[model samples]
Target: MADAAFTQGAETADRGRLWVVLYLATTGLVLLLMMLAGLWMRLAQSGWLDTDPALFYQLMTVHGTGMVGIAALGGAAVLWHFLSAHIRLHAWVMGANFWLFLIGVVAILAADFPGRFGGAWTFLYPLPASSQGVWPVWAAALHLGGLLVIGVGFLIWCLELARGIIATYGGLGRGLGWHVLFGGSTKDVPPPTVVAATMVAIVTILALIAGATVLVMSLINLAFPSVELNPLLAKNLIYFFGHTFINATIYMGVIAVYELLPRITGRPWKTTKVFLAGWTLSTTMVLIIFPHHLLMDFAMPVWAMAIGQVFSYVNSFPVLVVTGLGALAILHRSGIRWDLVSTLLLISVFGWMAGVIPAVVDATVAVNSVMHNTLWVPGHFHFYLLLGLLPMIFAFMIHLVRVEDVTPRGGDLAAILYLLFGLTFVTMFLVGGWASVPRRWAEHLPEWQIWDQIAVITAAGVITLTTVFVAMFLARTPAMLAKG
Candidate 1:
């Protein structure tokens, strides 16, 4: 019986590793491909290529949807692998999640490329139905249907995680370490577990909202063309889902930091009441924070917009104050040797913090009134997702492989080039937005073309260096694992 149990454990370990590789590889390839699409659009806007406007919008739709999906998948992989060490996450569930994501991605790609669906990633109501012959009604339906499938998959994954936590840690409140926050003992709960608890709780509610608002509505519209869903309600639902989904990506991606930083820093990241309190605050705030995305909707309630700005301010405080300060204090004068993984992890926190400034500014109704339609929207997200979450994902990928003392040659050069060029690329977007340049345009005025040109050049360098780094990392994985 003991031997059988040991064999079962070994099989689970092997399957977990395989799932990690599958998720990582799929996400990395998709990200690079979408980055290429983004580059093409930017170059076309710079007047270097006379691409058709319809084609540009189609690419935009794919790139936008693909990037968000990939980010969530990559972050889920990181969180799942690490969380498994502390809890009982079934390998088959994760495998199913990956397959579901892949199916949804393929469906979306078909709709965008072959079916020629181009209502932008948001797929706002009326627009999907009113594509003006650019795509068939069925194509738009397929696109939203694909997203619904993915949403169902995500709901399943989150439910499993929640179940695992509940079974292992007694209940949701205990898993979240809320007992300690409410004046109980904090001795047993793990910090990473608290983060996982926070994520699952928040995402579960938001996912339901997404299904009801965006995916279900879209499906209903397709089946009953005269269903007459409220446009304002649909818009609210779309942004709510879109905003929560991407924000969840960053939160999920940052789990790597909470789990791995202690290993690298030779410190214990305790699940103190304060820590739990911060995440608890985040848990409450993230749900209501979608209002910030709707600040520009005049039809939206003033109370909702006010709530958006207030939550935006309060939301930044908990995450930044708790995690940010804790991370810095852990790293400060620790005499720790900084390697690629450690450096990337550290930089990710700073990138996220820096990115929030722009985001908070944009969340304000006054500033959003002026900048919401500009490139600033993309600039803020690109900063956090690109420099912040993506680096954390890369770091976690590196963590998976048990490398020896020897570092790969050119690792530093690759990291430097990727970081430097990537920053310049996102910065140019912010600069252009400051200059009042609009987003999602295939053709830029001569004045705005310069920003597009510079962004393209920097993006090319970033992508090139990233490709080389990924190749090197993959090549070394087998040897590194063999050493174990």
Candidate 2:
């Protein structure tokens, strides 16, 4: 009976592994397509591509929504793949979320393309309903409905993870090592993966709830023009949901660094009290920091904005400092061999840390007054997502397909190229932000076109390298799956 139970668990792990590979493949394909859309926008801004203004916004809508959605899905894959080792998770939950996610993607694409709904990804309250004649009511409803579908899928995913963690660890607090941190009990302290997963599950569940509330109310408002929501309330909910959801992706993706880095360096990433405290601090602060996104709105409560500003400074440090120092300490005397995975993982640490500087800068009320509407916003997020989160996801993919004595051809070159051009690309956005170039504009002035043009060229390089990475993953996926 014990042997049979072991066999069953192995089979379950194999099935989960297969689904994770599929999730990564989907994520790679979508990421490549989104990069193309972003490149096209840059080209249009540089006057190299003749895109219709409507199409540009449409592409912007799809690109933003698609990238965020795929990031969450990919992050879930990373979280589940590693967390499963510590706790039993249902493979069917992963499969169910995948199908639901695909369904949501289809609905969103149809709404953006044929339906012509382009109010931007935020879909901000009345904007979806107030598109004039650019799009019909059905388009707006479909778009909102699609988002609702996606949120539902992710909600289930987070819940399943939470359920697993709670069942295994006795409670979410214990999963986060709170007992070890506070109660001073050393027994059964959860690893970094569980602590991270616990944090993600708590925050993501809250984010999705906030997201669903606003989405449903907006859909109702759309269906009945008289049923209205306060614009400020809507903005708060939207940004809260949006900011938390996106930030949670980084937390989820960082698990790869935590789990894989020590393995590569022949070091153990133990969950000390410091690590637990760092995550605990971040888990609270990340939920409260979204108000920084609304700093420009005078209608928001002064206390909320203050919380946003203060916590923005505080939130940027805790987990990052702990993780950064942890990585360095582990690698210091480990004599680890530098490969594509290790290189990218280390770079992700730097990118995540560096990205926070600009984000915190913008989160300041005074600086946000000037830079909030500029390209600085995108620069800050793209810095982390492109350079930080993508590398983590990419490293995990390569790790999955990696074999002993078989080096991936040109893998290191592709990673280097990605980093170089990604830096240049995001730097162009920062430069443009310093020049006060407004973001989400379909066109740019002559002086602004230079930065856009440079960004266009750099974006092409980033996209090309990303394609190479994705192709490498795709080629090896079959073998990886078969081995599973």
Candidate 3:
């Protein structure tokens, strides 16, 4: 433990540690808040009770912005410590980065409800471009400024990664840096986590900042509709950011799982190299392949769209197959008894694996055009975001608690029940998405009503699960709460 401590001072390093804690708490709060609100809105749509449609839009906007922010900043924070291991006073830099990230979160959350009441979290330029009537100019400015702040924080951290890799391995070249930093493996090859994290950061940040630039240009285009803000390019920007965010979730979650699963089961995951290479290839390809989502939008070139479809299919499915199955192969040979955390982790993987079929199929050129904006998008993503990413966060939290020997006071059974209800019902939405039922619509024609019904039911179940999980956390407060 002493050697594990770096040259950084106790106070500064502790601040960095606190930042990570705050980030997770903030992330969980935002996630639960968004899901719970969504569930409520769905319940109202189902005729149980009605909530304000205006407020519902706010919830949607907050959800998107919050989730993206969490994945980018919070996810990076998780990897930062590993990368910062050798940096002297990395704690101070980490602490500052964390605060800046939190500042961004607060700004976004604050801007969401009050700003024009636009429900779209991605902001989809030209809509939020104007601030005269619906929302004041100040609000839009605040949101953009907040995003810029967050982006800068991450940019600084990436520089840290680059510097740290050089210090450790004597030089930072291409391919991979994270695996090398995490473990002292020297090689011409880099590890999957390093490649994924750094690439996700690079791709998403550049795309988002470009989207921001387009946003500014879009303000001019608002007056000149013919001036085209590159809706196609804008859509690509979103895909670049959105896809990487989801992938980063999987990448970071895998890193934590790889580290902890070994300690828990007394068996390290096998074929680490295969899993690493698989992720490296997949992340690189996925970065360029997001144009696949635009196949249905006829404005784009047919050939480009075709390339997207091919790459998207290849990137989405195969990586998970090799890596996920490889993980199972490693786990299968392990003889140790499973615990609550291990169960949840494996279950999370199951949800991700199951979710991929619909996502992969939906990305097909034929299917995407039909199901592009439907409940299917939500259905497919809930698997990756909710079941895949959320469970990892839960499992990681539990790992922290258990390692510290914190008492299992609050959430023993409640967490399990929540997982059951949450996942079992979320699948219904995936089915609806598969059938081409549109999402975010309050009412649709008879053909779409069936899918809407399923979504509503699933959303309500999520609410109930959220309530249970919250209760469990509160219950365990006395036992788990402690100081570093």
Number of the top-ranking candidate, with lDDT as the measure:
2
RMSD of 2: 1.0
**Per-residue C-alpha lDDT of model 1 across residues 329-403, encoded as one tens digit per residue:** 788888877677787788788888888889999999989988987999899999988889988888887777636
Tens digit of lDDT per residue, candidate 3, span 97-136?
A: 6778878777766676666445376666556665446666
lDDT winner between candidates 1 and 2: 2
Off by over 4 Å in 2: none
Regarding TM-score, does 2 or 3 come out ahead? 2
Please give the lDDT score for candidate 3.
Answer: 0.61
Order the candidates by TM-score, highest first. 2, 1, 3
lDDT (Cα, 0-100) at 473 in candidate 3: 42
Top candidate, metric TM-score: 2
lDDT of each: 0.81, 0.92, 0.61
Worst 10-residue lDDT window for candidate 1 reads 402-411
> For each candidate, C-alpha RMSD in Å?
1.7, 1.0, 4.4
lDDT for 198 in candidate 2 is 97
Off by over 4 Å in 3: 1-13, 81-89, 130-137, 170-205, 208-212, 215-228, 270-273, 403-416, 444-484
True lDDT of residue 334, candidate 3? 81
